[model samples]
Target: MANKKSTKTPAKAKKSDKKPGLIARGKAYMASVRSEMKRVVWPTKNELVNYTVAVCASLIVVGVSIAVLDLVISEGLVLFASLRG
Candidate 1:
């Protein structure tokens, strides 16, 4: 059989491959977040209100539709049970 090469690196090489400490990584992450936030285009007050209203209206319509469907299905099951009795 052919000889297998050693997978282990020297102690000095292992030290060079070590990653940044937790505190250094955390600081770098916060710096990136601050930089990205500066590039954001936040919505105006009027646009924010309009978006909120639209979302609320959609929720109300969906809720009503589901309530109606539930009522119909419940009534159907009741009628079927009465007929089976």
Candidate 2:
């Protein structure tokens, strides 16, 4: 294998590859975030209320279903144990 010549020395390459300072990076990140936020389609108050209600209703239904199943299984196990005794 032939030795390849590098145009930029290690020190020069490291300097050129150096990242921006913390504050500069933070500012750039915040600017990008602000621009992205501007593009978001936010829900109206009425829509938010509707969505909240729907989510609550769904949780209640699933919660009740799980609770009922748990109760049935527990009671069945207790009955089976009593029968065994």
Candidate 3:
């Protein structure tokens, strides 16, 4: 008895090749984005203002601290360099 091998046919390609226009797709994507934006919980005006003030104050404090530290280190290095000269 001889064994026979089964051969399978290849699948057919799809016929629908049409794509939507750029403007229509863009409008649809923007609409979805806007809807998602509406779902977000936004901060109150007072909270926003307070947070901004806090950030500015912290930044100023950090800037002043860094400046003082830099000046101290530079003066120390200069004093050491002069002593070595």
* TM-score for all models, in order of appearance: 0.78, 0.78, 0.72
User: Candidate 1's error at 44, in angstroms?
Assistant: 0.5
- Which residue runs of candidate 1 sit more than 4 Å off their true CA positions? 1-14, 83-85
**Better candidate number, 1 or 3, judged by lDDT:** 1
Clash pairs for candidate 3: none
Candidate 1: TM-score? 0.78
* Candidate 3: stretches off by over 4 Å: 1-9, 15-19, 83-85
Instruction: List per-prediction Cα lDDT, in the order shown.
Output: 0.93, 0.93, 0.92
Query: How far does residue 47 in candidate 2 sit from its true spot (Å)?
Result: 1.0
Pick the TM-score winner: 1
lDDT of 1 at 1: 65
TM-score pick, better of 2 and 3: 2
Per-residue lDDT of model 1, residues 1-85, tens digit only: 6999889885664457679999999999999999999999999999999999999999999999999999999989989888645
List the candidate numbers ranked by TM-score, top first.
Answer: 1, 2, 3
